[model samples]
Target: MTLLPDPAEARAARLACRQGAPRPTAGMAPGFTQCNMISLPKDWAWDFLLYAQRNPKPCPVLDVTDPGSHRTALAPKADLRTDIPLYRIWRDGVLAEETPDATAAWAEHPDLVTFLIGCSFTFETPLQQAGIEVRHIAQGCNVPMFLTDRDCRPAGRLHGKMVVSMRPIPAGRVAEAAMISGRTPAVHGAPVHIGAPEALGIADLSRPDFGDPVQIRPGEVPVFWACGVTPQAALMASKPPFAITHAPGYMFITDVPDTHWQV
Candidate 1:
């Protein structure tokens, strides 16, 4: 089993990530909030904001930074360019490169505006405490994520299918898992679907569009949650000229306590 990150070590964990740790953030910084990041050019900000507002389930907006600024009210001391474990540089909707540090991209586009979307990882600790097994964390790897046929409401230039993260829960605990996660609507809220991968148009669970696949034990049902990475799916479909996002499964850890968002 993967060792859970210290709740009190949010700053320390971010510092480690800044120093080039390549591990996924799942199960890391357990009590601190983790979020999906997407930085788009200044001109694209309003459209993206509208998109997130229209699709709150998969794109709950946590904190948005000012144009050309690297700071977020979510974490004052953390640097967005370097604190995330990994980043994807997108050009004209194509994935240009994955990098550990993104200072160059920020330096190049001073008008890049960053948005922090709530991550399902924020609710995992509560699920575990409620005795639900989070398969990906138990497997010591990144959570599995998939793109579904379900469409998100479009806002201006943004439009795409929804993306989801899956966790295999025992059939008996599926409802419990949903309830535990639903307490914090800001962080994905609840399972969007339980069992039946094909229902979402996901052909197979073993192969995921992003992140690693986790095992689905016989009695366990695959539960899906609205994923913040849906923005990347939009980037792929809409083909924005320039954008930067956290690599799937890698997240930006914020100093905010997870409980702060819990009901």
Candidate 2:
């Protein structure tokens, strides 16, 4: 396996993404922190911040940029507008456009406040180091994400159902995987559910609201983690006039090391 990525690699990954390499970033910059991004209007910042605070499990915040700023403290030199592999523009609760670059959108909305939220990918390395197979990475695909029946605590104009990223873990190792991940509370600590898609309002494992599906081999049980993508779902349900988010599975790689969040 490749050694843990260094800061240079992290920067290079972001640069590659900025330059238009449209690909999923699951195992990219392994061992470095990766984040989910949401850039909202400054007027709605307080409301969203409260929403995130109210639902920390799915919206754990890492760094929030100042209004109109294109940078985050998570990566001093990284451009939030273009460093992510792909971006989704939401207008009035509808997906407007999917782009590799969001510079134009950022310029149009100068009051945008960017939020860098924690991601489950941070715990992937630890899971791998412990001899577990993260099915999505092993299969070279994006993690499958689904919307649950549970509604999140609403704040201001933000409201939506919880979204979860699923990984099929060996039934015997489900507890071990949860404990390993539980150590990183800042990055979506642990599995919210295990082995029962129906319980989460998911009717099929093959179809996901976001991201691609991975195989669930024999004796492997499905495990779900609170996803930062939940914010996008809230945008749809709450009908925010304008918003920007990292396209599911295409994350913003940060300068922080994964170990920084590990307990």
Candidate 3:
């Protein structure tokens, strides 16, 4: 049996997994649910929220922060402004800077609204428990994500192609993997497509739009799922005045349980 790490350790492990460098934690609180975060000005909040609701597969809504409030009531005791290890600050849809803290950024624009999206990490534990191997974890690299030809149902001022993360599953176990992951719809649900990368317009499996690609050993078929990165793609295409997202893999741990997210 795979022993799950304690929440505190998991959070630390996640922090260590950040792109580079270690930062100080103001208060080390354990056992919280770490979510994927996005912050945008009040003007863009409505469109983004509607976009998330419309495209539930790629953008699963966990919680939305009140305008100008840095505290996340959904993950009470969790500070939306500073709990995450890293953040990407976007300017007119382009990634302008990355910082370890969003407190200063938030201070700059007090009218910003924050969003907490469900992340696949919530389902990973159960997937592993079911004997499915997550390639990125094994390779110690970020999961390979692709910008697919698939377009999300657009909301006002928000429109872009879907982004997906891929993992290779042994041919025989693909069905089981799908069933296990399908149970958690809030965090991306089941496989969007299975086998044959070309169907999704992915030309070379070795090259990915984001993150490092992993090996697909013989007998393993590639599996793809809608990813949280989809919204970032939308942000780019929409060219919002300002937006912020958790840097890839740097999620915000919340107090909720994975099982609670079952559809």
| TM-score on alpha carbons, each prediction | 0.96, 0.97, 0.89
Instruction: List residue ranges in candidate 2 displaced over 4 A.
Output: 1-4
Q: Number of clashing residue pairs in every model?
A: 0, 0, 8
Total clashes in model 2, counting residue pairs 3 or more apart in sequence or in different chains = 0
Ranking the candidates on TM-score from highest down gives 2, 1, 3
Each model's lDDT comes to 0.93, 0.93, 0.78
Model 2 C-alpha lDDT per residue in residues 22-103, reported as the tens digit of each score = 9999999888999999999999999999999999999999999989999788899988888999999999999999999999
Instruction: Give residue 252's error in model 2 in angstroms.
Output: 0.1
- When summed lDDT is taken over every stretch of 10 residues in candidate 1, the lowest stretch is 1-10
Error of 2 at 131 (Å): 0.7
Candidate 1, superposed: residue stretches over 4 Å from native: 1-8
lDDT of 1 by residue, 1-263 (tens): 44454555899889888896688999888888999999999999999999999999999999999998999999898999999999999999999999999999888898999999999999998888788878889889999999999999999989999999999999999998999899999999988999889999999999999999898889989999999999999999999899999999999999988988888
Pitting candidate 1 against candidate 3, the one with the higher TM-score is: 1
Cα misplacement distance, residue 221 of candidate 1 (Å): 0.4
Which candidate do you rate higher for lDDT, 1 or 3?
1
Candidate 1: residue pairs that collide: none
